[model samples]
Target: MTEVDIATKAPESDAQQDSSTNEPTDASQQMGEHEHCVTDRPTPAGQGSTGEIIKLNGVDVYISKPTDYPHTPSRLLLLLTGGTGIKSTNNQIQADIYASEGFLVLMPDLFGGEKAPGGKDTYFADNSTSLLEQVKLKAVEIAKSFMIDMWLARITEAKIMPILHKVIEAAHEEYADAIKYGEGIYAVGYCVGGRYVLLLAKGSHEAGNDEESGMVKAGPYIKAGALAHAASVTPDDFKNLQAPLSLVCVENDALFTDEVRKVGEDIMTQDNLEHEVQVYPGVPHGFAVTGQYQESAIMDAQVTAYEQMLAWVKDH
Candidate 1:
């Protein structure tokens, strides 16, 4: 599609805004001027041992460097939250594992900013006013509203600005504890964040492909540079998918059935780009980082994916 076609439409609609948050929103403000640059500020806490975690607006984001190597520089991995809550035991381990691999990690708290990190249950209504409390609680409704605003803003930036800022600070914080990393950059994610890796990748690529408009918003087929190296059960962004892509789906992810995932991958493969879809046995949605994983198998898969990506990056 042409820039004229994409730009003519606004950035977001009312329901699109609702997917990320639960609040009465100013549709105009929700689609604030697109952030062209990362914010200039100190890193947020739980970041580098020396780094800080601050609120990007109201969301909690932790930007940190690897504390082990302390002297070398490294690449970055921006970890997106799983849409409903704070770090899960498995996710925390995944982030730490990446750090151990000599990469900087940015864990943005998309919901903690709203004081309602209640996961899917966050939407569960309270019933105390009477036996039948059909009315939505004012407080729950309020948090939901505010959250949507922040959520949309984060999507606009992906985790780029925060990850960049962290790398800068970590150069000082863990100057010696780093490793020589990928020359330019790449992204990996999980759950909602995994989906984000694709969206951000597409946004990254879409910016290049659809130059007239400059960037794709947080919408369908709006992702840039994501098809390649992206891990997901759903890969329907077939036709417009631009990156060298790979897909990993759980054995039992109902919404992400193996057939559907393959269909997505098949589309990419037919596009003549490198694309593959593999499903793990006994895996479930959010199962990629658990202790139950076969260490050798997982490691082999990781190496394969990373190597494939580096090679593709070299050619692309």
Candidate 2:
């Protein structure tokens, strides 16, 4: 088997979010991935408790625990919202995959925690439009309510980007203070979340080492990222990413099927960015999750990615 271990210090990846230029708070990244996780305890040796909705400065965030976890400090993952949105994210099939492997998956509700059962969503090209429109509209309300500049205030945030950054910091803080669930972390983002991960990536500059060539000597921090079906990010949009990063795409998706994907690949490669790009065969846009008509190769590809990710974490 061709084992593609994407970096040194073990794991790595990189990301970005949104077309409109808006500034949000910074999100921190941590290191560590595990084969098992612990439950029924305060932060055990390498295990931390997950599964709770956190309120950081008034932002309500939700984290889902991985199933059948073996118990380790902590592992983190993300699912960015795209159009038509991923209504509810506690799906056993999806949640257990990482939890069983020892991860605390954060399915943040960028959109007020509205839960959806599931189904088909092909005709809506405005996939993220649902949430994006929300932020746009909310900006107005926030400005009116708080008496501030609409666009400027919106960029400063109370929305998705800020919430995401806060979540990262909150994860770091929780593990730091918690008696359990305190291992390292890595993030996985899809669509909007994928884009949001990049924002976290950009944040590396402020936190130091945005490319995340390896783990910071300080300790277990979110060390890498895996962005699936990501959106575009200009160099200036986000901070420097310190974590190693990956961007995955389904072969049939028009958004990144050709030149666009290559451009993203080129930027990372030229920068000697710690990252990888995998385009699974015969899969459409949201192949990793539901969205019907998914290919087995795509599913296997995800498994391979996580395995490689675990390996990278160990090395780090």
Candidate 3:
């Protein structure tokens, strides 16, 4: 597998200087001119606890624990939200749900908390938009895959990977006791977040083979990963996936079409990797996190996807 030197340390550059000079007070300040940033809004109160907002590497992440946390979580779940950004109610709901299930959920605002490039109001109010509109918007987003891929590439190289390293480092330090005895760290992401899940899995895989790889030294602690309605992922992304992975896709999702699914399946099978790819019929992209369950069929699919993710984490 060909590896990109993501961990290479270079002399301080102008971008580094800019980040230091313009420290973000809120999530919005984290966007660069060419980068897409999700807008900041009042996140709904996470169930039970509102969650603690902590800054790591100058980026803000909300950490929430189960109210009934038995002082020991089975694993730490790094929940990466889709392109809509981290503060969305949809994202909060998923985090709360995971926490309720006894997992420590850490959600970092990957877009630096800024509203995405198109505008600040691009996001629909959670549980407010009609299912029809949700489906249409998802399709539109998928149509822009080329542009989104470019944006993702730039952000991943410039910010996402480094922030990931820091988040893992922080999690180990903050939850030292729980992680020390827990099953291990795991990652779950939706849409664009899915792309990141693959990246981490690949990095973990590379690091496992080469102890000198920067990922091993940084210690992300990710034992396995799962992604749903992933976008902009190609076969190359899975080349170095070291841990077990589960991919949950919606049959009708434009971003994760049959062709994309085939590529993933073929590569993993050829490589003899431990992984599973599941596609649910008729559901659209964003079903796992944003699907309104008014329809019984959609509700069942969403429930199944979530269960699959939880099961994958446990099994691995």
Candidate 4:
């Protein structure tokens, strides 16, 4: 459970879509043709008490509430998933874990109906005799697969932002008293989910339009956020961040590379934003959510990262 601050730096990761980054304005114009992709929300897995699915503004959201929910002033969090979406067993478990810690968790189906092949342990290799070999096998699996590319194409930041805003607005209305009591919203993201949290942390602003006046926009509906093994995030994202943030980085990641991290830290510092970056060594991407925890290091880092996020929430 060791914590290494971003005092030093290093590579890019697989399952990444960097260099050409988030331009939500362009995406907004192209939305009409792809409305079907963004509008088609998925149904709940009906897994009993793990969580419950409710339609929030026509989007199916998996919600995990604290036992004393509504009766207690518990903070609310939007649990953003990786490529696995909300129905994945790992995300459900994660929502429950947050609930147990006294936070009402809401996870929306960002992928609509489609989800990654594996749930939670999506990166684990099959029948690997050793942990190191398993890591290698998983690397090959990501490298050789077309799923990441397809996912990038399907889940653009522009398409998902409106859905997230709608969910936040609906959740705020549905739990008005509870949210007012606990203050406001917070967010947590894993991998692809990580990218959105960054966008959210930037808060709402005008991205401009065809008119000279431009349209005002709002979003993310979060007071703060935390991210683990974020993918496809660019330097500009960090520069634009307006809310406090905590980042959990893995030793080996192609998506959130060393250069990218350094740039992020520099920009965050220059902008005078509150942020903390911690690195967990000897692990692959997605280790925070889906690592093989039987191994001591993996388990320790996973637990430590979760604690780090919780601490950030409480501190702010």
lDDT of each: 0.41, 0.44, 0.63, 0.66
Q: What would the TM-scores of all predictions be?
A: 0.48, 0.55, 0.69, 0.74
| Candidate with maximal TM-score | 4
Candidate 1: where is the Cα deviation over 4 Å?
1-52, 55-59, 68-70, 84-89, 112-181, 203-236, 291-316
For each of the candidates, the C-alpha root-mean-square deviation to the true structure, in angstroms, is 14.3, 15.2, 14.1, 11.4
lDDT of 4 by residue, 1-316 (tens): 0111110000011122122322122222122112111121122245324788889988889999888877777888888887767766666777888888888888998877675533112222223235576456455444434445566667786677767877876877897765776677889998788888998787565555212223345643578899998877788878668889999997646667878988998998998989999988875566677323334666678789999998897777
- Candidate 1 vs candidate 4, lDDT winner: 4
C-alpha positional error of residue 196 in candidate 2 after TM-score superposition, expressed in Å = 1.8
Number of the candidate with higher TM-score, 1 or 2 = 2
Residue 23 lDDT in candidate 2: 24
C-alpha positional error of residue 239 in candidate 3 after TM-score superposition, expressed in Å: 0.2
Regions more than 4 Å wrong, model 3: 1-49, 117-154, 203-221, 290-293
Q: Give each model's clash number.
A: 32, 54, 9, 5
Q: 132-239 in candidate 2: lDDT tens per residue? A: 654564354333323211222232223555456555566566644221333445666654456666665553323344222222333323556666665433444323
Q: Rank the candidates by lDDT, best first.
A: 4, 3, 2, 1
Cα lDDT for residue 181, candidate 1: 49
Worst 10 residues of 1 by lDDT: 33-42
lDDT of 1 by residue, 1-316 (tens): 2433332222222113242224323322222211101111112234433344654433455655567644666665555545433334444554565566666665666443443222221122222333233234334434544554355445433344333333334432443232234433444554445555554444224434343333433433211122212223355445545545445555545434556666766666676755555565532243343223323554455444444433433333
